[model samples]
Target: MKIPHKAHVALVDGERFLFLRNDGQIFDPKLSKVEEPDLEATNFSAGVKHQDQGGQISGSTDLNELAHAAAAAEWLNAKALANAFDELVVVADPKTLGEMRRHYHKELEKRLVGEVDKALTHEPLEKIGEVLANA
Candidate 1:
């Protein structure tokens, strides 16, 4: 597969796994596009610490959380788009759609944070705008 020179970040938040493709055109995560996979649960048992908090958790656990959040966000997006696509079955699912949106976003939030962290891990403390400039 031809991986683009573009940078990408993959991570699991609550109940979802997210893949962010960086186009280097926007600041921070402004124009980043995210793809999420349907995950099982939040069970980080891999001993990842919570940022100098003295607690450790597993990667699995963290992934679960990300999945859930991502699913919630998907639900919300579906709802907002529901009215636009009256012909689609998903558009008719108002309640389920809402739940999915919230879940999708909840899960994605963690993943987004992780993605950003990884991208900046080796950086020399620069604003997201600097990265976008490379585009």
Candidate 2:
């Protein structure tokens, strides 16, 4: 459960994300913030609706789904800045994690170290390390 020094860690949700770099102190690792993307209010619809063949109604896409996609895209951009990391850890809710997995570039996939499928985006920074370690 020991994270390597300078490993990249990302805590993410459907609407927000935080990137950090571990300082290598396993017992008391310091996570220096690298990037924190601003999240905007999700718009559910653009005033358009359509009926399916089954007479079901829906918008072009669910706003929540769109938000998750956006978050994943933002994460990809941030990861690209680092080009590649020694190791990469991702912590996110199950749904968001799936979204990220779907969008991961081949290079990023090779760099992935671990993934914690839980929503720890709102947890305290100190607690986050514990969760990741336990996972």
Candidate 3:
């Protein structure tokens, strides 16, 4: 499925997660698979990691299961939604990035409005603070 340029990708595997950039580019994940002992032993179906023996188990579900119904489970692609993000780029400082996104992104977007027409090309991302302040 094609995700929007604006949409963020997060590669989540159970308790762990990695964040990826959309960058309006298509990428193929060079995934590594693990072999499961038996298919009957599985609690979930089709994981993000490949399984040579019993097959992968999936996690990500659309609309949430209890949030929806059986028809939703039958229809939605769980694996793709769960193992999101084309590429997982490790950030040096996660706390800072989280703070920026949580505290600044929306305010920057809201403050910039129509003035950000040439934003991607002209404005240096480092200078976002200036643009946001200008608004």
Off by over 4 Å in 3: 26-135
| CA lDDT of every candidate | 0.34, 0.67, 0.26
Against the true structure, candidate 3 has what lDDT? 0.26
Weakest 10 consecutive residues, lDDT, candidate 2? 46-55
- TM-score of every candidate: 0.26, 0.71, 0.20
Best by TM-score: 2
For residues 1-135, write the lDDT of model 3, one tens digit per residue. 333343333322222223333344323222222211111212233222233444323533322211222222211123234543222221212322222222222323332112111122122333422332343
- What is the per-residue lDDT of model 1 for residues 1-135, given as tens digits with 9 covering 90 to 100? 111334444432333344445454334433243554554434333223322333224332333343354454454335334432111111112222333334443333323222122223233223332443332
lDDT of 2 by residue, 1-135 (tens): 666678878888766788888875754556778888665534333111322433234343344654654555455556665785667878787766766676677777777877878888787877887766656
